[model samples]
Target: MNIILGASGQVGSNIVKELISHNLPVRAVIRSRNPGFDSQVEIRTADLFNPEQLTDALEGGNTVFLLTPEDPASNDIIGETQQIINNYKQAIHANGIKRVVGLSCIGAHVEANTGNVLMSRMLEQGFADLDIEKIFIRPSYYFSNWLGFLETVEQYGVLPTFFPEDLEVDMNSPIDVATFIAKVIAHKSRSSDVFELVGPQKYSSRQVAETFSKLLDKHVELQPVPKEKWNETLASAGFTASTTANLVDMTQAVIDDIVVPENPDAVCLPTTLYQYLKEKLEK
Candidate 1:
């Protein structure tokens, strides 16, 4: 049996659908019932932080897809991740699951000084000694995250950003990420491996704005917010102090180029930023 945690999320849901499209039976472990999934998929409701509940959900599963959701309400980012890793450890042991595919970030190879990347880095490290065969999919930033900026563009004719305006960065659609995961599941090879996923094209903030302009048929300018004012801006935006601080650190990592893909020769997924944006706009 194959199990998928975070089944309601963008990447996880896409993965669930992809697996089902291939006629693979999947057990979706979710915190709450979401009727979005097809009837062929099995549903298991459990709080991910609950060891007993998670263990029960993993019962008889041979493979598992793991991802840790962010809890901005918590002040202790590292502590929260540690507890999650611990829970996964306990659940994996209880079920004796052997094959695994983990969703991680691109900068996960950085051992230190890369704020949010540390959470992913530590996640991969935690699974190192396990006897199970594992493949970690470290993808670039999700293109879906930019959807939130469309409202700003529509209202103010500008897209706000924290990073440098011309800094080129990797991007990928969640659908593409899921498709790659399905491929990995079908062809499980290495005992432990990492695949760096990215969209067909890299985009800077200006390029992003240009893409938006082309899609929206309006001139959307790039508004680069100075890093010094992030705290005040995030606070005004209603983010908790801890969440704000964590985001600031992660943004800094991007500015420092710590989140760039480790493998320059990594294959680009079929989806492009323009294609993703076009789909969203058309919808």
Candidate 2:
């Protein structure tokens, strides 16, 4: 059986749908009951932080999809994430799981001080010694991240971003990510592997604004939040001081061009920014 953690989330939920489309046996593990899953999916409620609940959730599952859910409001995000990783380690061992497919980030290879990316690094390192097939999927910036600024773009004709106007960054669609993950899980592979996933092309903030302009028929402009105001901006968004600091560091890392895939030959998914935005707007 294939067990999917964080099954309520976008990527996880899409993965569930993809697997179900293939008529595979799946157990969806979520913190709370969600009635949206198909009849074939076995829903299991389990808190990721609770060892006993997680262990029970993993019972009889041969392969597991693992990911650390984000808690941006936490005062100690790193420590909290580490604790969750420890719980997963314990639960995986107790259940004797055969394979683990981890959702990581592009900059997860960096060892120290990469803000949110550190969580992925910790996840990879935490399970390094475990005698199981480990496959880490490191995806670039998600195109869905831009959905948060849709209201601002629609109402004010302005797109707010931390990136520079002309700086191109790798991005991918969550649908593509889920599709790749489902295929990997369905395929029988014994050797451990790391796959870096990206979209067909890189996109700049200016290009995103242009796409919005074209879609909304308005003169949308890019509003790059200056580095000096990152802390102020994040704090106003209701993030804790520590969380804001970490986010600022992560933003800086991106601007400094530190977040690159370790493997040069990354798997490019066929989802352009314009296509993604067009579908989102149509929806």
Candidate 3:
């Protein structure tokens, strides 16, 4: 059976759909299973931190999708990552899961310093210890994040452009990236791989606003805010300031043209910002 972590998320959900579309049995290790999945897929709820439970979840599964959701407050990022890696490391060795497709970030293995670079570096360390065949899908920033404030943009004509309006953002629709992941996961290959998944073009804040305006048929304004201000804005809506700052800094990096896709094979897939907005907003 195939296994997918973070199965309830947008990427995981779309991957499960695609795997089912290809008629493969899937085992999902998720905190909560979404209702959209087929009943044939096995759903397991277990404490990820517990080594034994994590190993057991890998049982009877040949492939596992490793998608670790971030915890910003972890004092020792390296230590926290080690704990997570030990689990996957043990599972890969014992169960010998042939294919492990890890959902990671764009600069995951790059030799550069940036806002989200820490997590990518840690994932690099964690992945290195694994014995099984692996593929790391270092996707660019997700476009779905913008959908959160669609109502605000539509009604107020203003949107919190997460990254700078001038920086080119490597973006992708969650669905398209997941499809490629599912294809790789279902059909095993002898070769190991790491691929960056990005949108067709780099888009700045103004460009994103332009895309929104064209799709929604209304003028959308790009309103840049300070990291602290962005924190206050997010806190009012129920998120921590530090977490918001990381997001804001990441966006500002985009504006400063700091983010880049290092992998030459980074795919320019078929989802556009306008289409995402049109489909999401119309709903």
Candidate 4:
């Protein structure tokens, strides 16, 4: 059986839909019961942080899709991920999970001093001792991150970000990532490996704004929020100090070109930023 963790979130929700479209049975382990899923899907209301509940949710599940939730209340990203490591290890061992599809980011190759990438590195290491098949998906920066700037666009006709306006970076949609996950889950003889998923093209902040402008049929300017004021700006926006600091460091790494794919030969998904924008707008 294939079980999905973080099934209520955007990527996991889309993965559930993709799997269902293939007429496959999936167990969705979510913190709350959601009405958005199809009737054929099985929903397990459980908190992954709770060991007992996590073990229960992992029972009878062979292929597990693991995605950790980012809690804003916790300022310690590393500490939080450490707890996740413990939980996953205990639960998978107790339940005898045979296959794992873990969600991670491109820079996870770095084990230290790389902000959020540290968590993914730790997660990848945690599962290594387990005698099971594993696939750690390292996707590029999510294109849906632009949704955070939509209010700014509506209010000021501008898309603001810490990234350089002209610095092109790999971007992928959640839908494309979900599709890839579904395919991997359905494939019969996939060995344990790491995969880097990216969009059909690279895009800069300015190019993203231009794409949005074309879709919205309005002038949208790209504004780079200054790094000097990042702490104050992010705090005002309700991010904790640790999160703000990690984000600043992560964005700096991107600017320094330290977050590129470790495996350039990995397959790229076929979703373009323009195609994603048009579909989102139409919805």
Instruction: Give each model a TM-score.
Output: 0.96, 0.98, 0.88, 0.96
What is the TM-score of candidate 3? 0.88
lDDT of 2 by residue, 225-266 (tens): 998998999899889988898888887788888888888899
Which residue ranges in model 2 land beyond 4 Å of their true spot? 33-35
Which pairs of residues clash in candidate 1, taking residues 3 or more apart in a chain or in different chains?
none
How many steric overlaps does candidate 4 have? 0
lDDT of 1 by residue, 1-283 (tens): 8799999888888888989998897999999869489999999998977899999999999889998677767688778888888999899998899988899989999865787777888888888889889789999888987887889998888999988999988888988998889778767576789999888888898999999999889999899999889998888877778777878888999888878888887769898889999998898
Give residue 152's lDDT in candidate 1 (0 to 100): 95
Give the clashing residue pairs of candidate 3, or none: 163-251, 165-205, 167-254, 167-255
Positional deviation of residue 91's Cα in model 2 after best superposition, in angstroms: 0.5
For each candidate in the order shown, give its overall lDDT on alpha carbons. Answer: 0.87, 0.92, 0.75, 0.85
After the best TM-score superposition of candidate 3, give how far the Cα of residue 23 lies from its true spot, in angstroms.
0.8
Clashing pairs in 2: none
Best candidate, TM-score: 2
Backbone atom clashes (below 3 Å) for every candidate: 0, 0, 4, 0
Q: For residues 187-256, could you state the per-residue lDDT of candidate 4 as single tens digits?
A: 8555899999888889999999999899888999888889898888888988898887777778888888
Ranking by lDDT: 2, 1, 4, 3
Model 4: residues with Cα > 4 Å off, grouped in runs: 33-35
Top lDDT model: 2
Q: Which is the winner by lDDT between candidate 1 and candidate 3? A: 1
- Greater-lDDT candidate between 3 and 4: 4
Residue 238 of candidate 3: its Cα lDDT?
54
Off by over 4 Å in 3: 71-82, 227-231, 234-237
The superposed Cα distance between candidate 3 and the true structure at residue 214, in angstroms, equals: 3.1
